[model samples]
Target: MKFGYRIIFIVSVVIFFLNCAYYYPFFSDDSLISLRYTQRFIEGKGLNWNDGHPVEGYSNLFWILCTAILGKSGLDLIWAARILGLACSVGTIAVILNCFRKLHVKKEYVFFATLLFVTTPCISVWAIGGLEQPLYGFLLTLVLTEVLYIITSKSFRRIYLLSVWLGLLALTRPDGFLFTIITAGFLLFTYRQTKTNLLTITLAVVCIPTLFLLSQLAFRYTYYGELVPNTALVKVKITFHHILHGAFYTLSSFLGTFVLSFLGLYSLFILVIRKKDLFGFYLLLNIAAWISYITLVGGDIFPAYRHYYVVLIFFIFSIILGLKLNLPNWVHNKLQAGIAILIVINVFLQYNIPQNHRAVEERWEFKGMNLGSTLKNTFPDKTLIAVTAAGCIPYASELPTVDMMGLNDYYIPRHPPANFGTGILAHELGDADYVMTRNPDIVIFDVGNTPSFYIGEQLKKNKTFTKNFIKVTASDRDADYILFFNTYGNSTGIKRTDSELTIPGYLFRNNEDNAVLFTKKKLLKKMSINNRYEIILNDIPSKNWKIKNVLGKNLEVDTEIYQKNGQLTIIMIPKKELLLESLVLEGKD
Candidate 1:
């Protein structure tokens, strides 16, 4: 009877996961970036965004490689990945349940908690999103299961297995190091009870992961010349604003995904401090650590909270752990049943609440797939492209793109943004100057399926931009209406400009009569502090010119230079009917 019940419970959870996956079947824009990497690898171009250029665009190195393996075998990319990820997602429930069974959690309670976990929108979406999160979550649960075995029983073989599992966890995601560190705490806390010795402990906790990490680091550093992935510098701005956003993200995730959004954190407290349950403590500690890390980096901006998928799973596990420790276990069982019932009700009652509505309205999910198909069919390989979105455009088009928002580009993430005050995320900021320098053949602005970027608007203000890049009026197969600009020299073999164009800073105001320059060269301003600038004004300016004087509201040849952080806005107001001529910008000896 017990065996039959276990099989039915597992089957039911699997069924629930499949239904949710099919109901909200959409691939994330971010996942396409990895798919592109996998494609490049299989095509013998290596694991890079382009054939020659090797940039570690993705942080999920192991998964990228795994997908490449599947692609290499001549299987359909999306279906194969979905099949594999679904298996891993289903495996997560079984592993977690087995741990609970071993920990002596009640069978009914285990079934209920596991059901709620598998059905949660956050878990269901990523489980079938064709990303590595499902596999990452699976590896994480396996590590947790092995740790549980170590705490409950003592064996050298189990110790070795725990080390291997933890190492695999780290390989799945770099942040898995936190889990290994916290598990060391669990090991030492119960060292005497479990009879784990010093040598074994040292090797398992520190040595195994260290060896794996070192090999990866050595290769990555030698290849990319950077220790961390290129994406890290672009993201993870640990500022006050980012921390606040992280805190807000945590609350919103809990509230949005479950019937009672705040209960997960509260239950974690009850399980750890009140019940004194060691397993609960482990889960809570890991959750706290992961949340702190995510908060420091700023919670992920993607819908469905994809970044916190692993943490959410652990969080649900922690909540279940607390439920296992409740007074008069039947009352706790009733509460669990109620929570699960609420989730089922919301899935149907509020079908569009979690993320389905926005995803449908914005076509957020299909943007990448659509753009990818268009690019692969329309553009040839080696076409130099630039786009606000780094993922879909490069992946779909197979174009060696200058990632304007800097996910794959090396220079964009390392430099300060050209203009600000409007972008959605700091890490997604684009360098207009750098993009202009790269001179891509096709520059897609807010158009296409990805979110539109204001950086394109910022670039439009540049004079060289208007001269060299012309806007295309036609729309692509995708309904993205954002502007698309083609570089001047795309068709013409000859360079349009007579002389090389180099400006000290951004050209904010560039017109026929008067031009204004916002110079970021603060050092020049500081040096010119005592020295007066030779302000030459045109003798005649157009009637549209508001100012007839170039200096201090009066027409003068000399003007004093004042430095504000070495930046100066040079506004040239010419004399009536006269245009600024023979522009000379040279430093004195």
Candidate 2:
């Protein structure tokens, strides 16, 4: 292969590795939900729920396309989707390299630009994740590159291609409408002399989104009885404070990722001093304007830095302009080397950060466990599991569940709580045979105390059922305790011995008190619980325990234990909630 092709191939492999590493565990909650939606589509359940409520938390076009092509039980759908993203990211690199070569940019500048795109931490991380960002980044780069081409060539054919790309961009992200608006403004301002050609291009671009919106509107009206789904629930109230906060956050996030925003500023200063590179200036202005617009209209801004992927175009042109401008060879080379080093350091720091490592590890373990399979094994086939979302359970176990959050409008008739709390739980558990919570309580510190009080109060006040089920704690990696209230009579009082509960390759420990703990042996070193070690027994019922005082390992307790329904209920209540900073529960089956 030629040197350019070889460079492209290496960059492609690097992008693939970065994505795979980032999404190594593969399926995330977001991807799992998307896959479930696609499966529903395949099953002819319609886009809405069985009750005909409109499902619109997320856009379904991508899911529909994937399901149509890949079929059901192709369980590694996330990997497949990420591979598509990888292809787009690689395509973006090719387009950038080709655009530079065609513009007669310096070979060194072209290589550097390619490197910047390939190693960009923010872009590389998203390329393999289940989000639509990589696809958006690729299409945005391609569309903008074509826009530049159309400006220089002024060819109707190039303009037509631009229109096609604009359509694709809109399909990928709703924000693509902003791109369409900016393009229209650019054409009217720059191509007044060729009014007819500009009009034709603008019309072509407008028609694609116009048709798409109309079809969506029709679907919404038919299914949701409104033009948009969940619009009423999710409102955007933009204030000056919000805009200012968003602007500062967006800039800070961008700088945090690239560290090139500072360098880009210096390069801008150099360009202005030389009075050169008008095209580069225009591209930079366009990017800046779009970024400002995004900041102003911010909704979900946690991952705002991902928006800066569009700046790849501006970065490429600016570097080329720097090379072309009249300056001493040594000065140019030194600046280039410094900028490259800074970028490489930024990428390394961001990718290798301890928090990012933890996130990747956690996501992988959570997705790998197949919670659906566990639920099926633990409960009856006809059991109605009340989950925060219906994504994984339904697809994995073929169980009917009530989504507490009402995603995709699944529980429209039930009208579940807007938030996940007592209200949703109250409604869901009323009819549910068993309750399963990924995290039972919002506050992790006081789980035992709070849940016991809440459940006690609810049971006493409400006469929905006669029996108060016991809390069963199961050991899991992501959650130390899986607390559930089993209503079935098959709830055996038998507590299995440590030897009987042994799983090979997993650590099993049995304390003298018969408490069994399970964990991976490697993670034992990292586990610590400060100075205070307290164990709150879930079997406890009465809260009348008086602590004589903490004597070292054991606390003197004066309390009575009662056996109810052939089960031991012990209450080892703490004197104060804050006296103990950490509490470690020894797991026993």
C-alpha lDDT of residue 147 in model 2: 72
**Deviation (Å) of 387 in candidate 2:** 3.3
TM-score winner among the candidates?
1
Worst 10 residues of 1 by lDDT: 521-530
Q: Which run of 10 residues does model 2 get worst, by summed lDDT?
A: 501-510
Residue-by-residue lDDT tens digits, candidate 1, 388-471:
666666666676778777788788777755432223544446767778787776667533422246556657776656655534
Against the unseen true structure, what C-alpha lDDT does each candidate score? 0.61, 0.48
Model 2, 316-366: lDDT tens digits are 566556655644676754666765686578568667654334435545324
Please give the lDDT score for candidate 1: 0.61
